[model samples]
Target: MFGKKEFAMSVHHRSARFLHHHPVAQVLTVFSFWLIGEALVRVLGNPLPGGIVGLGLLLVLLAMRRISTLSMRRGAGWFLSDMLLFFVPAVLAVLDHPELFGLTGLKILFVILASTALVMLATAFTVDRCWKYLGDRKEREHA
Candidate 1:
């Protein structure tokens, strides 16, 4: 639907004002996900869902020091900002499934509520423990 001039104009507009401003961060972000995402979708008929595989790939790259936090800051910030929007589509899709809340809906709802509560509790406990461990380590180091 887009014409060549429109596409070229958009490119010029974007190129005129660099996103995130940092070249390295932009490069890493683009290289780590956008480039890989395109390749995976093109080469592999069945590509993994967005963010999931990209995140795993990013983590692997970070672990290997192929991409550093400094080079990922701007891109990471952009991703964090847009992360919630990505979940909106899935939520909208679920809303289309009104039957999911039919006769067995109550039971399913109960299970989901309980499991969600359990996950929250577990997450809270884990966070508390991690903080405690880190605090203790800091104190010990200072001692």
Candidate 2:
């Protein structure tokens, strides 16, 4: 008894709701994007790591509005909350290497600290600019 337009809207709403409720699906969505990036790298022979490529692809899709941020919110939050887990293996690997306790290790530590600070600063600036841009756009649209 539903019209085409209504049916399409209904499906969209249902799927959006499903994504909102299911964190696993959101995570899978993120993983699938990564897989696509890996496939692209293998096919195109790009020098970048697959994870970086995958993130770039995700950024493009987001910027082009092909994907909605709301759908990724929960999954992103989950990842952020447990981000330390991702670095655990690296920490463990460092422990396995005795050479890392010398001056070389100190140099590596300093580089890691400096790079992390730079990345954090850059990310904060970028987020601030993006927030202002979106706010201004919304105001302009309303005016």
Candidate 3:
């Protein structure tokens, strides 16, 4: 039992080292998926944005075990950790466009609220549907 525990710990340590060694590789892996998504959009002329499509493709790959998040987690986490930095540019742009605040301020606020609510509803519905489907599958499997 002790030997097995030691081996498992060693494996975990090695995996951690592997992830740390080439952190940029993880970011590139993600970017490659996005590029592929963009290419697909250009070729297929999809109405959806390439970045969104790429994100969905990444999800599918992760779900199918074709891609592992192990290496990507650190890089992705770093990006998320400093996420507010990304909004700086957009915030600055809005600040520059002070004219937009004069006549269209309320309109922009309304649109932002409406879009946010729509996104929340859509996300909630998708999560509920997926949860139900998975729960039903588990029941069928047990039955």
Which of the numbered candidates is closest to the native, going by highest TM-score?
2
lDDT by residue for model 3 (1-143), tens: 55998998888777656766677867776678789989999999999999899889989978997557886887777767888998977877877788778768888888999999999999999999999999999999999
TM-score of each: 0.49, 0.63, 0.55
Off by over 4 Å in 1: 1-20, 23-28, 31-34, 37-57, 60-66, 120-143
Model 2 lDDT per residue over 5-39, tens place: 99998998898888888999998888888899899
Worst 10 residues of 3 by lDDT: 12-21
Per-candidate total of colliding backbone pairs: 0, 0, 0
Q: CA shift at 17, candidate 1, in angstroms?
A: 15
lDDT of 2 at 140: 100
**Which residue runs of candidate 3 sit more than 4 Å off their true CA positions?**
1-21, 100-143
lDDT ranking from best candidate downward: 2, 3, 1
* Native-to-model Cα distance after best TM-score fit, residue 78 in candidate 1, in Å: 1.5
Candidate order by decreasing TM-score: 2, 3, 1
lDDT of 1 at 45: 62
